[model samples]
Target: RVLVAEPRRIAARAAARRMAWLLGERPGGKVGFTVRGERQAGRGTVVEVVTTGVLLQRLQRDQELAGVDVVVLDECHERHLDADTAAAFLLDVRATLRPDLRLIAASATTDAEGWARLLGDGGTDGGGVEDGRADGTGGGADGSGSERWDGRPGKPAPVVSAPGVSHPVEVVWAPPERPVRPPHGMRVDPALLDHVAAVVRRALREREGDVLCFLPGVGEIARVAGKLGGLDGAEVLQVHGRAPAAVQEAVLSGADGGRRRVVLATSVAESSLTVPGVRIVVDCGLAREPRMDHARGLSALTTVRASRAAARQRAGRAGREAPGVVYRCWPEAEDARLPRFPSPEIAGADLTAFALQTACWGDPDASGLALLDPPPAGAMTAARETLTAIGAVDTAGRATERGTRMARLGLHPRLARALIDGAKEVGARRAAEVVALLSEEPPREYGDDLAAAWRTARHGGDPYATRWRQEARRLEHALTPETSARRGTARGGDGPGRSENGPGRGGDDPEHSSGDPGRRGDGPGRGSDQRGGGGPSRGEDGPGHGGDPRGGGGPARRGDGPRGDNLPTRGSDLRGGNGPARRGDGPGRGGHDPARGGDGPRGG
Candidate 1:
């Protein structure tokens, strides 16, 4: 059996489907896939595609990978932390227990030499890890070993370079005529997208089999798709992580009977799956990445220029099947200024989850692991501190019992904390729903209220709601009934103050509504540190997008809008999910579950 690990769930399914088609059978036959809560494999399945996270979980359960003969890490150049960790773990397995296991780091363009060195030739069975460096022809990171390269012990592995594309690709520079503002904090200049739409039209008019337009996010894809309407019966579809399953199938299946298709996609399409019939590529030259927002206590998605390697990958899509043309949406000279490769996720994303993973793996500080780049010192420190506060790790930087449970859930540490604690505050079902919503986030069409969004997902039959149901069910099943210390505490009162009694002990002497002893300087049962961070003036400790409210992320840290729910709860007007922000929707009203939007009660 061969196991192919893709970076995202969508890619896994698409890859499986593509393979199944080639085998003259449907999925569940020789080629199948298994993602987080979904699976489509049968006893006869020989090739199974899964997300990197799923492969990591399998390794945790059984390091031997028992029945599998080979493991392939597809799209190795993406540089996701999970993929890197998995590669390291796989190398370790190959050197020790699974000597017979074959590892392959597959990519259209990669530093065969660098990867060849990192993945020593243990034999033909030794799987090669990607060096993540770009080959000069374009398809990898810097290929510069100078940038914190993995110095792990391994002899050079054999190189297996695939030949270049058989088709020729013409490149056309299509920069907007007028100067446009650069992208910032999830906001892309409208002018740029408009220009991209124009470029797509030009491609369809002058050349083309099918047009594959690359955009940054789902929102951008939707906007570009919206503009390509009335294209004389040409189908406009979207391809992203959030895109519906049927849509993915159609995109991969190509336009039936040669009907035209304008498939607008995200970076996932860079190397994941080939959208059949695509010969014209429209490159927007923008990508979105997550960065920690220190002021907001949240991780914000920022829009930036696509890396040069990524632009090359996008261009390659056009020339996959035949000679094609790529419309570069920026000036040819400007391409020189673009970054060589995307910033490794380890460098910018919130490291709390990665830290917890390392802790659970028994290498809390990650000193023992072999990685391409070490975790940033400050980020590691912050992540460990957050984990300690959440009781997921001990002072010695080891995983606690609670931490082990959190790791098993495959959720962010903060969200897992919320799921466990909120299960006690609210019931298991409600808590799971809310946590799932917080984790995956409801669609923009799901309305502005978080609680209302849950109800919409519960009652609606749309693709987003279906996925929400699957995730919610998974969380609901994973919930542990163990009664913890944080259970039943007043919401937003998870500050530092020991209390075995009701409402916790802190601040000025006061009394809980239960007549038990409590503290003041806060709402009843609240703490002196109003924002709920364990620190003196910290503002975090939450499961909300407002992460580590001053300490560890949970809820009610920042963006605690008028409802004090921290999450954007729908009411008179909740903008950008910053919670309620209008008259009659201000905080402090009893009998209302600010988030639930029902009579359940107010809290996370």
Candidate 2:
């Protein structure tokens, strides 16, 4: 069996289909694909294409990749963190467990030598050189110069040279007439999108084939696509990670006969999938890279100049079928000034998920994995710290059972935690839907309201909605039996905010929990014929003391001031507040506990 790792989901599916077509069969027949929430493969499949993240999961589950004879990491130059990690894992497998496994890293642009060295020496560079092929067969005479594979484990993997058929891509300087400000975190100058849109229009007028314009992010793609509006004789589509699956398919499928297309895409198209009729490329010369704001303890995508290699790859999209031209939105001088290659995601991106994967794979700190570049120490530490807080990993950075479950859900730890708790509070279906939204953010058109966005998904027939439903279902199914059962139990009446006393019925501390901040007796003693926590006072309004409105029954006292005393709360906020919730608020009655479908919180 052959497993091909692609950086993006679209690429995985498209590559599978293309390979299956070339084999004169439908996908899942001889070639199949598996992405995060979907799979189109059968046991009869011989070649399977999957995204790097999927491959990582497979590796964590089965380190040996049993029965898999060949593994191909495509588009290695892209430097996606998952791909790099998968590559490192495969190298480890070959060196230790599956010595017979054949590995191939297919990339056209980056330093082939560097990859060969990394692949050969298990991360260390110094090694004997080899010009021969590994085990597996390849073309020696097709004239395309593409390397044929041979399986073998050697000091540094063999470097097979490929000089496939090519056409010249003419570069044109099409800088904006007016100076535009450089990009900042997620902010691209609107003027640049305007310039890019104009360039697309100009390319359509002057160039012949379909135009593929590279934008920095999803927002930029959307803006340029809007500027293109609805073009006559051409279909304008947006392509990126968040693009509606249908829209992405349309881009991959190409336009109708005699119809042109202007595909505004992110860098995913750089080497992932080749748009069908692309002959004119509009290079926006911008890209978004992940950056960890250490001070703020958050990760953000900062827009910057696209690396020269990325620009070349984007420009090469135009010349895939015939001679084409690339309209550089920046002057040629700037091209020379750009970095030679895009930074690897591991360097700056949040490493929590990656760290979790490493922990699951037995490399708690990932120090042993063979990588093109090591993940930053500070980033790894931060990630481990987060894992510890979420209880996803132990103090030793080892994945806990919960962490393993979270990893299998294919979500970030935070979202995974939300899903688990949400299922108990809400239901499996509801938790799945919301988590799916957070996982692959809704399209811009979905609006800023999450609830509204969810409703749109529930009723709309748009591709985003379609994909969301599919993902939501997948997530629901992924929920553990324990979690699903817990949700069912909650719905059956024994869940959060449901104690038979009042809204916040729970084990109570004495004296208004002594956490209330009102003047001495003003807090109204706890046992004073009144409760002031999750529920209302049994008697009157009671004291001026509500313990903590901040929920969490965490460290604060019931109806206490903000952040409260250091003493722990009696129990979780599950039962309304610091005391037993009233039967009305309980699951069986007309209580207004928001946990279920109830309207809101109610008094004791």
Candidate 3:
């Protein structure tokens, strides 16, 4: 029996809600749904839930059959990595292991023709021949109608069905234009700023609905929102991941009585859920992502152009209710350069979780797992090494019992270490403080000086910083003598019974050499601060192979009086060679050859 459900009958929101409810029920011990507040199940037969893009991530970890009957991929044309990966992974699984399973890829303005091809559609089923079929019909291959549905004049094909029909979209051409570019080498383009501001002002003037300006990151959003100042008769709201939930709700809800609203947001607004009544979209065409540089042992952030797919989805935000306008901050020519799909987080993110989960799953060679885009070998190796260094993974590359417990915390391994250390020394107070800070933005008001940074953080009233300090206090209050107070409570106390509690009470400053200015410190050793004429207290800590004078050291010098014996000589001058008309054959001409072992030349 084929089911025909109206698009509005079961919308994405309704479906998500339904799934969330279903997952809330406990099944067997095989499936589960976990959210921030609570985890509904440990193991179950079927699970469904809403998380901030963590579902697709979880699925990526388990590539085999997950016993799912159907995957309703809603809003896929959003071009989110999570949605794209879910669709691709489902297709792969259907083609490989679970051919009986079904995939309902839903999108308001998806590339239907292209997707039909991916679904093995043929020409005979009202789908184009490019749909991986012959004559638009199921070529009578592996026994199912495979293509014909909704009666499009073929062999009664039951392989596919068309939910509804749509009229062709007509394009209205505007004059060609380009956004001004920044000077070479600078990443932030001023032209982008002007373009964004212009679009926003236009939206406020003409559009009655809320305006959403998609910026690259929180920093750019903040800067632009500040420039906009609060718009008259409009609630100017800035939204980002780190903002408080109440602030997010206010921004997302907009002003009273359907008033004009402007939400300055990041890429987090790109998908998953829709903010009501947004009809004007201002796109900056830039997004920030972390890309790994394995050689550097760090992940660097880069801002790059958004994909055409992403741009289209953003534009679709305008047409959700009625036809609206989308302003692109970049020249149309740059659209071609955008990536077709966003990069996977797994490819570039810190892989502490990858290491932990793979260990739990009994896969030692996680790099060898059949990933769509595998992580770099160096990154995987680095993750393993980090795990071992933290004792999460043993010499054999297996997760210890402690590692398992730490994984339950859902924190990065390093943060977990800090938490454990903090708990053991200062009670739970300091550990929670450090954990919260590590999870959110670091202490922002602090300058380059570490001591000053700590001091400023201690006094700053920003919610993020305050929450961290509060957690630190909680950890401190949670301390037990057997676990914490018994430990040393002073700095430079790294030996037995050393306490981990309180900053500046842990160990010696590694950069100092035991308060001895003359003693060389670690690495390229510091110069000794000694009194003048203190028996060469500060020696040049240069390379053992000697060094060039062009460096920091002083040049070699010679004494004024080199010859011990003196004799009266004619045509000799002390000041300049011009006055010194000395001759080689004259008296005192047979001088010692200083270059030849200090021996004077033989007197002829």
What lDDT tens digits, residue by residue, belong to model 3 across residues 331-405?
Answer: 656667867655554566445545665665455545323333455676678778766766677888888876654
The per-prediction CA RMSD against the true structure, in angstroms, equals 12.4, 14.8, 21.7
Over 1-604, each residue of candidate 2 has an lDDT whose tens digit, in order, gives: 9998776556777899899989999898889987654567887999998766667767776899888988888877767666677888887888799877778787666656656656665322322112221222222222122221223333445566555545788999999999998865445678888998999999899989899887655446556677888687988876654455677788888777778888876666777578988999998887655456666444434556788777877877877778999999998777788998777878886677778888988898888877878889999998888778767899999999988877766555655665665566556777677655544334435553344556677888876577667757766876865553343211111111111111110111011001111101111112111222121221121111122232111121232221112112222122222343332221111111121111112211
Once model 3 is optimally superposed onto the true structure by TM-score, how far is the C-alpha of residue 3 displaced, in angstroms? 22
Q: What is the TM-score of each candidate against the true structure?
A: 0.77, 0.75, 0.56
**Top TM-score model:** 1
Ranking by lDDT: 1, 2, 3
Q: Which ten residues in a row have the lowest lDDT in candidate 3?
A: 504-513
For candidate 3, the per-residue lDDT at 373 reads 49
Off by over 4 Å in 2: 122-154, 230-232, 444-447, 481-604
Please write out the lDDT profile of model 1 over residues 259-335, one tens digit for every residue: 79898876657776678798999998977554554444344345678888788888988877898899999999999
TM-score, cand. 2: 0.75
Alpha carbon lDDT at 151, candidate 3: 28
Better of 2 and 3 by TM-score: 2
